[model samples]
Target: MTTAPHAETFHSDGTPDASGRRVGVLLSHGFTGSPASIVPWGRYLAEQGYAVAVPRLPGHGTTWQDMTTTRYDDYYAEIEREFDALRARTDVVVVGGLSMGGCLVLQLAERRADQVAGVVLVNPAVNSTNKQLLLLPVMKHLVKAFPGIGSDIKKEGVVESAYDKTPLKPLASMVAAWKQVRAGLGEVTAPVLLFRSAEDHVVDPSSARIILDGIASADVTERVLAESYHVATLDNDAPQIFAESAEFVARVTSQVAAS
Candidate 1:
């Protein structure tokens, strides 16, 4: 199967800081999706001189069938590797992601609260209100996959480079990770900026509500994307996500510097 060109990993060699410590941002894509979904946002951060890493999660950027072989631990391992690399090189690190990517970053924030500078999430998916997901444990044993939940963009004619099918086993693993992360939300103390699309088909508003209500971060900001859907990073309100994320990194890092 031929993958879309945008699905490839993106990297930007932003200028190093004068103080010999870099400022970096790590952007992760959603489940069954590649970096293509968030490349524009990463590019925006790169242009502002923040070293950006958008790694293709394991089992993604290839094919849906390939994703079936991987589990959520493998996906989080990729993000953790990227996070460690950035933490070593940068003085302050800001973590951001799209959907499952957002959940992964929250896990990272919970584990590395002392190192993470800030957090940015666009339509983050932590929990689903859909009752059908409750049957995943049993259904995954009989069914191998389900219809894809990708490309939920409100903008016309735009397509997200994501898997056409959702692998039930991997999805079950993802849901388990979501539960683990959600339970630890109170441990995340970094400044957070969240962008929730008003009409998302894939992730329910409860995901955002749970995050906002659970996280202990006192500096939490939520902006509703009026013109987008689940993939707001690539939808009509993408510019808002890009601009606000850049501003968020700058603001939080400066605050750290001052403190």
Candidate 2:
């Protein structure tokens, strides 16, 4: 029932870029996870003088039981609100996420193509080949949850501070929303930078394949995180994620500003 420290929402208005343009980045955490997982990444970007917003999804950051009270729409609605707020203050915005957060930002790119300057995804999950997930609709009614998918970091001392249980109802909703997100992937025209861990335990390679194959963006880059796991943003390769994403943001935003 208690929220973890650093699980709260984080935002910054940021200083203007070299172009005197105020650019922004919005990051969403994954299902059953909170902003605590990605705040460091956001902070890294904010320090680069880019406005940043990291919103805690509705059902997360509290307890698994609390997550049962919400659905995927609740989470996406919060992302939409934060995206709109960032857009209000910045000339252009680049959206990114980890896991389900990645899927949520992809939805943003689909619906607001003109507004999203670029997309950065870390271990984004869109589809799963897991046979157990197929039983979610029936299993959710019979049971409350399964084991948690938290703290899949390859680093020994690092823990994700995420929920210990994966609420079935919310998980099912996320799966359903994936269909919707996949349907609109072709609408996502913004350049995409995706990072997949070579040794991930939470999300598998299928999700990445679906995303790369479905999106319409011609400018897509995929990098393999050789040393990290699912939570690469907080794993051993975090520095790589932060530095490269900063470069990705710079390249895309400048292109958008020029055009």
- lDDT assessment of candidate 2: 0.94
What's the TM-score of every candidate structure? 0.96, 0.98
Q: Top model by TM-score, which number? A: 2
lDDT of each: 0.91, 0.94
- Angstrom error of the Cα, residue 147, model 1: value is 0.8
How many Å off is the CA of 230 in candidate 1?
0.5
Mind sharing the TM-score for model 2?
Answer: 0.98
- The per-residue C-alpha lDDT of model 1 at residue 182 equals 90
Clash count per candidate:
0, 0
RMSD in angstroms, all models?
1.4, 0.9
Candidate 2, residue 211: the lDDT equals 94
Per-residue lDDT for 114 in model 1? 94
Task: For candidate 1, write residues 1-259 as lDDT tens digits.
Answer: 5656778888776776665656899999999889989898898889989989999998898888888889999998999999998877778899999999999999999999998999999989899999999999999999999999999998999989788899999999999888899999999999999999989999999999999999999999999999998999999999988988889998898899889
